[model samples]
Target chain A: MPKPNRSFDKSLWVFHVNTGSCNGCDIEILAALTPRYDVERFGIKLVGSPRHADALLVTGPVSRDMVDKLKRFYEQVPDPKEVIVVGSCGISGGVFHESYDLAGPVDRIIPVDVYVPGCPPRPEAIIDGVVKAWMKLERLRGENR
Target chain B: MADEIIHFVEIIIGVFLVAVFGMIFGLLTKGIDRKLAAHMQWRVGPPVIQPFLDVKKLFCKENVVPRNAVAWLYNVAPIVCLTSVIAILLYIPMGSIPPILKGYGDVILILYLLTIPSLAMVAGGFASGSPFATVGAQREMVLMMSYEFPLATTIIALGWKISTLYPGEAAFSLTTFTKYPVWNIMGPFGIIGAIILLVVMILVTTGEITKVPFDIAEAETEIAEGVFVEYSGRNLGLFYLADAVKTVVMASLIVALFFPYNLSTYLGSSIHLPSIAWNAIDFLFYLLKLEIVIFFSMTFIRVSVARFKVDQVVKVYWGYLTLAALIALVLIALDILL
Candidate 1:
């Protein structure tokens, strides 16, 4: 396990990107920040621009139209970062997999460090996934050594 | 019959006003969540009025139902959900007035009451008969099955503890329990049990609310707006309002359970303060505490976490958290016996 006070994993910032969602996942994602399931209590934030983000929260199937935008966002984020695909769509192309105008299942395009797989996962589950990602980041950095 | 009619009318008026306030409160919380999330990421989010505007726009738009839908249920579901969500607020004790349904029962009724909107969604989805709606309803049923076990276990443990703490209490009311608060009790194991139960309850509550990572039933990307696939215009707007109101009702229930504080208590003596002063102070404290709990305990979690897979969620609740709760119950029972 990485030491309790690992600097790199502690202050991770997230960017929420929607490739082609019907807004259910997006609303649930917003629900995370609501008074009911606020995740900020753990210091995880949702960043707007990927350039400054340490984590990417991709929600929705990667539509052909939005694939370039998603790739651009992912590449812009600095290295040693993590990507979290938030809903089933982001991971498996979900219901949208059969769509004619799609290039989804986000991992095919960008590396995903964690997969939170509810239609839209709960806030606490999301937190657990992010924490898992942080640990994953530590493991990748070989910090345990 | 005459007296009952008057009482019923009074309740109707009271619930109507509370429902209106609940909507306003729900929208404000939504805005706050957006603003906070935006600030967390260092960007300017939309104004708080955005949700209201969106809902307003939805209202003005044309209403549409799928050609094959069971028109009555599709149209009626949102109203039913919204009404039930508003009705839930009546059972909770916001501040003073004991509880709207105190004589009827508090948590016992509230617990079952909380499930109504979700049930409405399920029924509505089934009525639509769309592929997306059908899948969404199936997910909703499974999700309900997944969380209800843990939630019920937690509530039972809480109810038993509350009853044990105050023996000879006839009513299993949450308002009564809150009127007397649980954290003040002694015994190390009991405290641990309470803390463990509280954590489990928070998890179960979040899951029950269908927010964040727990939101699989209506997951738009996965199920094409899930249960809401065929709804549009005012019908869609009502469901939105119902969902929002449910959020408030759930948060309020938690506050009532774990942290019911009366500001009049802080005045040192309830009798010393004038009746008006005591009432005002008590009301102020109640609202403040509720807001603080929402901001700290609930919304904070929403911001920091990601979503979970359907099977993973089922595993987490039944496989892991359920065991934790059972063990905690065992410990609490042991403590009580010893």
Candidate 2:
């Protein structure tokens, strides 16, 4: 395959998914889009459909009931896409790590390009995580050639 | 025979130029609308070239056809939608240039052409075979029916006054409106009627273009991008371009009908500049007018209001707006008789 073009790097439309976690990270994700943070300055938009997305911004730990749905959502996103696992719950199942119904630490279910670990990462930190995903995209472009 | 051949060639070239102009200016207006909306919210928006970058990026991505879709119809609809919008531009004059196929079409023809794009979208949504798209398509059809009555009434009211004023001419030709602007031809009562019609027309424009408060068919939060739920890559890009061009068409139609006065006609002789310079000046002024119309009708309205439910959309257009249009029609008739 030829190198992935960098044209999409500037306008990254993200699809946010909640995989059975507390609403903390989801609120922060919305906060990142508010006037104060305004990630649109860097061309980051939260699109409603996965088919239109360039990156998947997943929140919450994967629970038993959400495992299949999360995988289905990942499959729906088209190629040349990246995944950003947001919130500590998605990274290590957070406080739910010891629960019997826990099935996550998102990397085990899907390939994750960036991990934004916090009980609920601050809006600025979420923006930083998106930048990290862009860096990974650049590195992948380098390797493809 | 020779004259006919030359005319045919001129039309072909005119169509090409109009298509190109529509795409460029349409996208530029969309960029401006976004920036103005963002600023209104106290945020620094994406760069003005953001829409261009987005179209480019979309073209490079994969085109995905869903398994259940009617593949041929799904693929063909975007082309039809975009082409029909360009066709409407051919009938309506732009700035100082006469419409490409001027005598071949009129206001009624332009009205019919305007609906083709939305109908194509409805077809595409139904062909996609997605439940969300099916519901979106139904709402789009309902909205189209609701708005067409007032829109047709506004055009007919203007045409009626023109016919009464000049008995033997082509009353419905768009050129006639530019020639005898409705504001100049009527009595005091008629002017009030025209203003009410103008307000009605602006509100109809809101529904025609499907911006916020009127965009129930594509309510992203409720329907997941609604009619566009299944589109991806180049197909989505085409729909985006169609939308931008349609905005230009709607704004230009409003300008041509109510505010046809040109700066050059007023200031051309005073400045003593060449004719070409005057034309350029008029075109620039027309663009400024278009931007202002789009900002007030689309951008400001979109930012300030939330989406209405599909039922509420139907009620607003059919009930209140249609009644307002009828009252304006009656007032104009009274102005003519009394």
lDDT on C-alpha atoms for all candidate structures? 0.73, 0.89
Best by TM-score: 2
Residues B74-138, candidate 2: write the lDDT tens digits: 99999999999999989887667678999998999999999999999999999999898998898
TM-scores vs. true structure, each candidate: 0.68, 0.97
For model 1, what is the alpha-carbon lDDT of residue B262? 70
For candidate 1, give the lDDT. 0.73
Query: Lowest summed lDDT over 10 consecutive residues: which window, candidate 1 chain B?
Result: B53-62
Name the runs in model 2 displaced over 4 angstroms: A1-4
- Total clashing residue pairs per candidate? 37, 0
Q: Estimate the Cα RMSD of every predicted model relative to the unseen true structure.
A: 14.9, 1.3
lDDT of 1 at B1: 100
Could you tell me the TM-score of chain A in candidate 2?
Answer: 0.95
